[model samples]
Target: MDWIAEMTDEDTALWRSDLGLIADAARQAGDVALGYFNQSPEVWWKNEGRSPVSAADFAANQKLESILRAARPDYGWLSEETDDDGDRLSRETLFIIDPIDGTRAFLAGQDLWCVSVAVVRHGRPVAGVLYAPALEEFYEAVEGGVALKNGRPITVSTTPLDAPGRFAIAEDVLKAFPEALKHRIERVRHVPSLAYRIAMVADGQIDGTFVKHNSHDWDLAAADLILERAGGRLVDLQGEAPLYNRIQVSHGELCAATAPRLADLLRGIGERRGS
Candidate 1:
């Protein structure tokens, strides 16, 4: 115990207990977005064909920021809708948020979008929540705790690695799968929200999913923790886990699957990447 005297990390239990606040904030954000969803909120493009943002996204972002920041003033903030502050890098804990993930889907009146949020300390997520208002699914997870969906516990699909499994994947990512494995894997219809797609994997609704390059921490953090607690993981194609709240928020190619199938999925992805 004498080797490390200066470590002053917050108790994990404290973080777990605060999931209620994150859940409430996320739900409130979702409510703000629902007011605009399908009713057609003003939309605009960002990154020149790479992404879109809506008025709903901004409204929800403001609501979430006001709620979460006021509750925990010490936490840093990273959000898809907010401009980078750079000050978050020095804080011990931070809020990673996606006011409305799947803004494209929401603009198109699809119900797959969500409000995603997570608390990360020292580069690892300590607590997380994903709330999909239309779907009415609220996922929660904390370090060393079971994942939950709508207040009921959930876990990843137990489908064997070599057996037929449903993969919620993108068209490009699907092309990367080995032909043989592709035959056995059923490609699930495209899911627009990165956070919702990952939650499907956590609740065993889908066996796995792939993330395209250039995803950000806000898009992945909350769901990553849920999937992790559900006995699943989201890792780079090379099988390395990601660290959050970094100076560079963009992430590389990634895949998520239950633990029993992580290796198999990664191997197939690596093969395709090499080819």
Candidate 2:
């Protein structure tokens, strides 16, 4: 009874303790990814040509699931590296993850991919971690707590959205909106991993990121929570907060930014999409 009482608390220490456990699991998964890096491991495609999963992804996912489930057997698991299961719906706390967020970048030696993990309570990510082994960076956040990178506190940039600032976007996003190319983005860099891009936004490495439709829940869960915790914003260009655990995992056209004009940018994109 004392152990059960200790696990339940209204204090910050309780949340941190649980988050610390989750962070440890994420770091372990990152190590699994590091082992496969630059070693020419086997790779394969899934869901036609859109999503790719590798042996590295599976390896890391296995480690993550094992560690987390062993710690909290009651929590449900949702992951990009695993098949969808409706059973997760019955659980209150769910583990959402992307074993290798930027598989393409990982395979190509780009070092932008990360292992993303989150503990979603009810419908929101209350705690999360993003571990980029290649960059030696670890970003994490607990509910109502500050965001951090590698144990040091991090904050988002306060620059206005219209100001010249770096932006991470998908390569195909250009084809979707050619006019975006003229929108005064300070720099448009393509990163293969959505979670890392979100982490970069949180860490102030970039001012913003624009993601198109079809990104899955695992891709954005951890980073989404991280950016929010860092005092930034993320939502569909349509102006809706992203949701998870739906039958359709694909999220449509999300834009994340630390700028005050974050809403304006979303409004502008909405107007363009309507026109």
Quick one: best lDDT, which candidate? 1
For candidate 2, write residues 1-275 as lDDT tens digits: 23323444574575677689889998989998999999999988887877677899999999998898898898888998888789888887788988999899999988888999988766667788999999999999987788999898888887765566677765555345436543655556677788888888898888888887788888888888889889887888656678777667788778998756576566556655774
Model 2 TM-score on a 0 to 1 scale = 0.89
Per-prediction TM-score: 0.93, 0.89
Go through the candidates in order and give each one's C-alpha lDDT.
0.87, 0.81
lDDT tens digits, residue span 2-33, model 1 = 21233334565578656878989999999999
In terms of lDDT, the poorest run of 10 residues in model 2 is: 1-10
C-alpha lDDT of residue 210 in model 2: 84
Q: Which stretches of candidate 2 lie over 4 Å from their true place?
A: 1-14, 170-183
